[model samples]
Target chain A: MSTQASPETVAPRDGGDGGVPEPSPTAGRSGPRQRRSGGWFVLPFAVCFGLFMLWPVVHGIAMSFTDESLTLAGTSFVGFDNYVEAFGDAAVWNALGNTLFFTLITTVPLVLIALGMALLVHTGLAGQWLWRLAFFAPYLLPVAVVTLIWQWVYQPDLGLANQLLNALGFGPVGWLSDEAVAMWAIALLTVWWTVGFNFLLYLAALQSLPDTLYEAAALDGAGAWRRLWSITLPQLRRTTVLVGMLQVLASLKVFDQIYILTKGGPNDSTRPILEYIYDVGFTGYRLGYASAISYLFFALIIVVSIAQLRFFPRQEG
Target chain B: MTGAHPRRHDRFTVDRRRFLRLSLTASGAALAPGLLTGCGAPAPGGDGVGLKIWDLFSGGDGLLMDEMMDTVRGGPDGFTLDRTILEWGPSYYTKLAMAAAGGRAPDVAVLHLSRMPGYAPGGLLDPFDLELLAEFGITREDFPPALWERAQWEGRLYAVPLDTHPFIVFYDLDVAERAGVLDGAGRLIQPGSPGAMLETSAALAEAHGGAGLLFGHVTDPAQNWRIFNALYAQTGAAFDLPESGPAIDTDAAVRVVSFLQELFDGRTNPNHLDYFGALASFTESRGAMIAVGEWELPTLRSTGIRLGAAPFVNVFGEPAVATDSHSYVLPRQERPDPARRREAHRYVAAMLRQSLTWAGAGHLPAYQPVLAEPGYAELDPQSSYTEAGDLAVLDPPAWFAGSGSLFQDRMSQAIQPALLGRASAEAAVDRMVRECADLLDQPNPVR
Candidate 1:
């Protein structure tokens, strides 16, 4: 069904400006008036953005400079002290390392496994709808529900994972308790829960690939494997880049599942930077220090994003 | 172009206008009940004294508290109780702090006595009127001196003592009998010392064909700290937090950690068990005994297991156990209502009088009168550990030391490696001293 509709959907993008209809002759004369009317329509969104997003950013930056706390205690301006302390904080460094390690482990598998699933589904597998649904269903679940299910599965003794391993003559493993294995277990669950979104992206990219290229490749005696390597993979390059970037950014921000699962325990091995901020701010009652650490993390994310953009510059038509 | 489809456009515009009107009317109809209800309910209690109480009680304790609240609601005092049960731990405390800071806190809330120093000094809680409490028949004399003193800050009473929940031992009666560890009165014969405790555990292990004791040492920092504190306290070591650092006795701390290592050597007790796992092990008969807080009494009883409980045995020179109390505190209010404050005091007094019902869940009541009652002593297993209240060793007074506080978290982190056999007991003690120094170096954020 998607095959017949692909050409019509793909035509506009490949054709670029050629696919555009000519503007009305009076458009230039009425443009300012139309723009004025459009401003009214955008005003509500502009107000919301300024209030919620812009205000918090400005306020948080201001808060990072003081000795603010959760107790509404007296505050003092401690110029650069919080930041200096954060730089010297060993816990902050440890949490950041854990976050980086998690991003490294989860991103590669999430991207590759998603692509494999999409490729299988795009090959006209029988019951296309079922395969697509099965691939995408886990992404629809809330993180709480996902963690609840995985918590049971990861239980050391009576859990299904160990039961299966025991049946196979292997000893029980502490999936959530052993310091060495906790992060890997959390990463595995995260991959299972979120690989669906990436799969859907890849599937759409696969479906939208032009059929004429495949036809030409087949005419040149290209087998399925060669076609996949020489044509399909290269065609999906932009999609792959997008998927990889999104996966890394998403993985770095991980907190909910790990927080619910282990509270970053078995000696804080799985604690991410975000959980550290939460612990310092709410649990430890040190909001100003938490804010400084937050800005440091924010700066790190920006640098990583800029590097990604520079290395994989967007493809222009 | 405008005139070409003028008639059809006119009809479409009219239909769109009608649809908008109809949709608006439909939405208004849908919202009518909610709007009415929002304004219709009379201030919750219709001129009666309404007390909003927040507590962190769940499991068997939650059910018992619910029953107590129900009785108060139905009593002749004409008091209406609005209760909220929050999740126990940092989340609950965080929300309470935020609410109190914002001046929108509940009339009364539960606060750990150990946490009183943090909150009371910060003015997050208002001092209670002793005369008012006395009017309600709750006096300072009614509580243990240590608990009452801990509930005060800067010479004013900020909390009313509730119950002291200490680290205790739960054993399967049948398993203990099979292992011949019970005494003449069916009480668990005291292990008395570390070596004797290990010997008894070995015997129990032989009888049960599994770990003799189930101590949840994995991933549960609170449990780790509780057991450590209880054992360390038994050493008669002085623990004080000074500005320089935690004044923990190094040799005593190492001794306790070494004993824990031997206890969790994978035979006497499984080192990998977690909170729920320990409960399961004890209930499933895989372990002869489990060492945990007395709070698990009702849960174990529900499983239909033949259970018995005793106070934490003396493993060193002194008989001491780490304990904390769940007390009632009046959170600071922007505009304190005299009548509502009075009602809160009454509610707490009423709850204290009903301590026997609370005792069923295994906490020793702080109200001394309740302990003297015939009914309290009749409670099996619960009454067995009444001495724990006197032997209680609360977390040392510090801004960061309390149940679910940062001090406990730090202690747990430092000691967990040793418990897991990844670090030496001496090294773990060093880490503990260093971490406590770090905490001491951090400026007190609670003011």
Candidate 2:
């Protein structure tokens, strides 16, 4: 994944400014000197990354093999016991299923709706600033603020949602209380809160597309829809892929909003795997088992990322 | 370069260096007091025995606690108290456990009596020095026997009981009067059986044009468990979870769940109110009565509604209401300072002695002397439910079963669906039993 960007950076340098300059003495010397200095520059981040991230990742794997607990009592190697139990654990499977479902529902709409909003805004609409601010403002709010706002909006009896429904001659819906509807409610709130980033990405991609192709198509009497399908969409494929990957990953890792809103409830219908792992490790005090479940989730995420990368290989210009 | 350019650059360097030095001195001056205080030398209230306390109290309860602490601060006991109020529930408990385990725990911390088994066995709490406590006029006889027994683990006192907050009935006096459910004494008529309770709720619902009884069973696991445990206990059923499995009478659980389902009938009680919603409904007089922990008393009183409170009535064969007590525990400390420990004991004793003030928030005082006070008897509505503390049935003792514990979460998951009509009562009971059995089958992490 890290290597994927190397070609793009190297390709631009090789092709775009080929005859710009012969290497000066300082420029030639900078290769080794900069490398030496860069080591110093990276030291602080490297140290932090090693301690906070790398060590935890390594220690967590080690702990997964033992019966470690938050109680700080005696711990003993349990070999494959925790993993074996997790594999057969109904709760783990249920949580994983919910997470995947959330990812699917949130990702598709986040991508499509963002693209639609970006295209709408890019069409030289009036009140463009207002549209942009309204579209992107939710993303600026913190998770706690976002959940608090949505919780009131999703209230069953007195909330705006049900009031609107009632005005339409429909009965009140239990947005956060009904098991079947709870996840959808969370997904809806999440889309509202985070779709802005994707929208901005799409809008940037749209703005950057060369106008020559569209102009030529227009000269040949191509309709707006025809031009959009042939030029605009194809030009924005990379952005779509980027947004889809990011949205899927973000949705998969969702915890804060759902935790604050439902605590994954109406019967654990909205509980993602991360919350389950949290409940097990912290609330249940079974840290070892939680670590095992976390590693399992980690492996699943790696497989998903690899599959996505393989399917949507990034195109280097 | 010209000579003038070098002098100009030198002057700029001197000015920048001076500016850096001045800013450094300014920041250092600003941070000095904070750094000194952080090192624990000169305490905030100088020359007093400083004691750090951690509590999970917020909203009405938090304000009352603060007032009580202020009284103690101004009392004859020259103790400086530093209290850290944290969010209630798992976040508080988890942080307290970690702090205790790390040997940097506060001098004293508030813990629910139901959580004693989990914390004590894990060595996160140090047993109280009973002799030291007795010096301050607190003894085993000071608290009710059942509550006192719960404050111990393996025959050692790990907590000093403060107050027992129980699930009691709160009613709108005006609504009850209009519905003709009030007795001659202006008290809520006791509903002796499930049928009678439903009848009362129906009448009240008609009077109020909304739900008669609001339980807030939706999306609130702790409340659901409290209501279920209270009703289930009334059936006089023995509930025991051994390694083999749950030995509960399944019929009793099913009956409790079914009764809850009926009570939450859309007209009699709203089916989709969370905890705050129920509080709002009752406050707004939309609901004639609400069944919840008495901690909501302050919120209800502030709304200026004519409110009446009563102990939970006997709906089954026996009388019971789910309850848990707030108690002070000494979080485990390595190489504990003797003077500070004694101060903690003194502080806890003082808090218990002055618990009549705490009772203003609707928690029944566990201190016998406080309960016997004329002031306590005079506390309207609060005094009306004193019997609930006696009839209190706490969450069955287990490592996982307690207020804000995973057991409550599991119970909520098992029973919420039934309450919502998505599952049958029998299915809910089965799920509860199966989940209990699963928890019991696992290794006790605390040990």
Candidate 3:
């Protein structure tokens, strides 16, 4: 996947040449004096990335070791104290617990269902463009828009969710009202709003699948389901693996969904880890603590992503 | 559904600090160049003397201040006003703290009096001199003493009382007339008991197409707890012991909690959240009454909703309503500046002097002179609750206390379940006391 996608795309054409020096190993071939000049190109970005992004990451790591806040004159470096405190805070654990549960509930079904949509649309079916448009339209909507729609739909009185329930002579689900049903309700909204993107990715991958494999499978008296299970699934494995990992990471940082619906809950039941980090940072004025939590989260995400990369040789195959 | 989506449109918000830091870094990046080329000015003086004022009073209050400042700046040349306008609520306080911590605070700012203690213990405020205040003609005798008490920290003045905005019970007078709740002056009469309130609420409910009496949900448990606090104050129930143990467990408090629980009709929640939601439906005459901050009156009036203001219900048969005062304060500056300080003082004085004009919008004036202004009593809603400032009830001063921070969040969290009928009132109050104990016990060693 990496090899196919790289495209050897250089940085933005002209590449920071607003009076900035050109950076290339070509300078080394030119001469020793010219080779030293390329350092200026690397210098500016290195300073910016180090200062803005990398420095904060390091500072956050350092802060995670301290039990200090911004109010104090000097942060007392109480080693591993914040982490211990964070673990004890039930709210933090609840957020993490909710985030993991939401991720598992949403990502698996979303990817598989999106895969089914991709397969159906990929087949020579009627109203091809209509199905594609219908499936892909919602993905273009913003998170706030999608959430707003769901918020109205999930409203208990005079809402479409309850209205639909009543119409079916079923019990009115407390979609975002009750603690028990809220996360799953948000997951359902997630499936509707974002399944399109995964579907598009899967469709693109399936389009690129070699026709010969399916034709060969068909020649052996393979029906639609058999062909899909053997040829189609194997062919789309790389895209599926990539999308699954990406979706898991995406779902873990679910802020806007939970924020709009339930707002971390009836009893902090719907709170996600990212929302907790945000609450700690901006809302509570604990930037030091929020940054520390964010970095810890970053490490966790990196570890999970690395584990995904471990599965890549087979994905490539 | 159309209007329900919060219209989120973003303009670029580059903060002054970040932008300054960016400019500084750019300038610093040019420092080597500046030293080499010698084109830059010297770095700004840390010891510079000038008046710095900060406040979160925007919209009409902001415009009035702007016009007032332009008049001041253009007036008899005595001093300069270095001003900063910060967005209000949580951001305002956070910025205030960060500025004080980084030692870049303004010399004058508006601090909600409820917030004084939190900043005070940290030495984030410079105590104002009574003698200095007397020269400015601000005497303790002139202002309401209860509000005046909110501005002091440790027997010293940290802030001057500017104005107080209390929750006034607003009713549709047209609906009230139908309910036969008329005073001798033909105004809406104030109810004085839990039963009288329910009776009046039932009357208002019947008059307004039988919609429930309250315009908002019990999810506003701070207001509910405040109702309890007022009742407890009347019945003499303390959440703390005569000196020990949590006393929210007291009998009077339990009765108050039960009484509040009874106010819910079992019909429905407001089907909305927050002030915006309540204010919207109230304007449409969906409900007959709402208890809300005075700041919302002008907005409601602008919606063409006729309103009558009364003191909140006297639950234990004594008048009590929660109030929070907004005062013009000086955020601490790192350096000393005499003249700039005087100008900041003059601006606060002038704003207070023009409090009648401020109240023309919505707020109740804290100044005695402003209250005595001719035709001050003629303003409809402002006149109605004008005396509410004279007898104010504020949240207890603590580091954890403010409008929507930990205290409100915890109080709201505990009581909202009971409002939903998910938890009993006893269970809700129990949860509140238990949680608040931990927060109260979370000591600030700095304090």
Candidate 4:
């Protein structure tokens, strides 16, 4: 069965099941002759991969069981003490709750808003190229730049946001000071900065959609909205799922925006788990405990990814 | 002319896309090592001939340090000074720790006085000799006893006192004049007591038609901790750590916390402005007074607003003010050179003698000689608040207790709800006591 569902599926026709496509029946008979060359070609990547990526993972897991500190000269084995401390630590729980709250508040809007933007731009908007560029431009900016822009925008008294509200006859809102509104303000900034990536993905999916389905629905006396509901929505299902899953993972690991915008402030209302881990590892100098918390978070990410895969098993043709 | 080698040349022609890819890969490979270390300089311990100093000063502080360095460089010390400015806070400490660990730390460095205990025990700092310091006319008696004691660890002096920057009250002179709170000399009259201070704030609030006293009580845990420390110091309470528990004065803690909560209850003092916002409100005349550190003196002075600064009044019945000092420390050297050590002492002494220049940047000089300089007594705001030097209440000595340490951050976070009116003052005090107990329970890894 083919795992390729989208029109631009990654699978090649002859290799739909696995491996490179066999151009002819005897293609595999010559595979051994090319295997050694392939191994030589992969040697440099494997070396670098082991040195930078694989070593850190293994070392981090080992350090999680010891009492390692960034500045201290020595460490001793502490078993699972750090993990136990984390389980009972209120700060950890508060940060975890904040992270999950941020994820929920951001993921749904990020997915739906990107879909809406893609549809609007794809509906023969004037200056098509400009619309595409504008929709996706924010994704290219550095996270620092995005947070800096929003920081000024969210300033309570003399900010542009309050000024806008004043013109609309609304009372000034404490965008960064109010604990209730601070995280939501960050979520709004996240949506504005990152919706561009998902928008581009949806736009690609929409462009690749076969026009024949819409034409057939049109012939059956369907209205424009009906055509969108019947043809466009269903065709975009796989991209929607992909976008949602990507957004959930991205939102779960949020650190940069919160670090710059709030530093988990207004009483830790916006503090996420990663910031907690950072505080432990770098700021607090408890590298071992920090590693344990991070590994726990890493395990959580893996479980979530597996659950997503089970729920949205790849469709095949 | 090259017809004979035409086929060979054609075989080596590169496409734009492939050439671009190759260039990117090459540049990235060349940049990887520097990116990993976060610095591009050749390794730290170089020759140890001239003074290799490290500091974390920027903006106004940076300007003052630059001026001082220029003076020292032109002096007859005849030794070169190589200065390295690191990003402040943990990043600076982390790099300093790593460099000391690698036996490549600079010859001289500046450290927060509160951090000395932590660094001293970890062997990241070297002890200074009293005889060497006295050769340059800087003796133990020339410093404030409270600050002088903080520069020691394990019965040895690990840091030399530089300057103390304390948390103080900055008031708008125009507003104070309107409220009739200023004396004949245009200085704010010291409130006799906490009750009197609250009345003064209320009167100022009525005159300004808004909150009178502004503080960064919303998100700045540091400021909240400073205020608490100041008030707690006034209660004459001490932090006593037993083997596995905290011995705190709960009554004093409750009293200070309750008083702070009332002070920021939105009638006399608004509790929501951040550090910058509070400063902005004071400068813009939206508020009559603000409580912050003297580091903001430059920003306030540049505003050209009618301003007056005073050491935090005896609001809690004592004139104590919370403060931290920046001092020179010698990072531990794997191999000590006598000549360099002597040079470091001379450099520190010269800097101390010129404390008048440093005072211009809004720091209270810890060196007693500078305070007696003929010109020092005439400096406007610095002289006005000179009493804070004697009144400075240093942070509690612990591995975690310091200006930017986790102790302040954690305690402030726990107590902020009371400031914001979300939690009862009693409950906030209880929470803080419990958190302090937990922190005390942790083993001192550095020790």
DockQ for each model: 0.20, 0.19, 0.16, 0.12
**Candidate 2: which stretches are off by over 4 Å?**
A1-33, A314-317, B1-49
Give me the runs in candidate 3 sitting further than 4 Å from their true place.
A1-39, A72-74, A116-175, A188-193, A212-222, A256-263, A278-299, A306-317, B1-53, B57-87, B129-132, B217-235, B239-250, B268-275, B443-446
lDDT of 1 by residue, A99-197 (tens): 999999999999999999999999999999999889889999999999889877887656789989999999888898778999999999999999988
Instruction: Tell me the native contact fraction for each prediction.
Output: 0.32, 0.37, 0.05, 0.11
User: In model 2 chain A, which range of ten residues has the least summed lDDT?
Assistant: A10-19
lDDT value for candidate 1? 0.81
lDDT of 3 by residue, B128-147 (tens): 76776777777888788877
Cα lDDT tens digits for candidate 4, B1-447: 122123222321212112212211222232243243334232434353467788988768778988888887884554578777876765576566655654556778888887776688888888998899999888998898878887888789999989999999888777788998888988888886778888889888988887799887555658888988888888788866554677778899888888888778766788766677788787777888889998888888888877788998777676789989999998876676777788889889888877888998889999988888989988878898999988988777776667677777767876777877778878877877787787777666565
lDDT of 3 by residue, A46-158 (tens): 89766754554555567667644444335567676566667677777788889899999999998999999988887879997789889989988998899878776776544
Candidate 2 interface RMS:
15.6
Give the TM-score of each candidate: 0.89, 0.90, 0.81, 0.88
TM-score of only chain B in every candidate structure: 0.88, 0.88, 0.83, 0.87
Question: Per-residue CA lDDT of candidate 2, range B291-406, in tens?
Answer: 88899888889989888999876788698988999999998875577778888899999899789999999999999889888898899898888988999899888888888888
Clashing pairs in 1: none
Segments of candidate 4 deviating more than 4 angstroms: A1-41, A129-134, A159-178, A314-317, B1-50, B241-243, B336-339
CA lDDT scores, all candidates in order:
0.81, 0.81, 0.65, 0.76
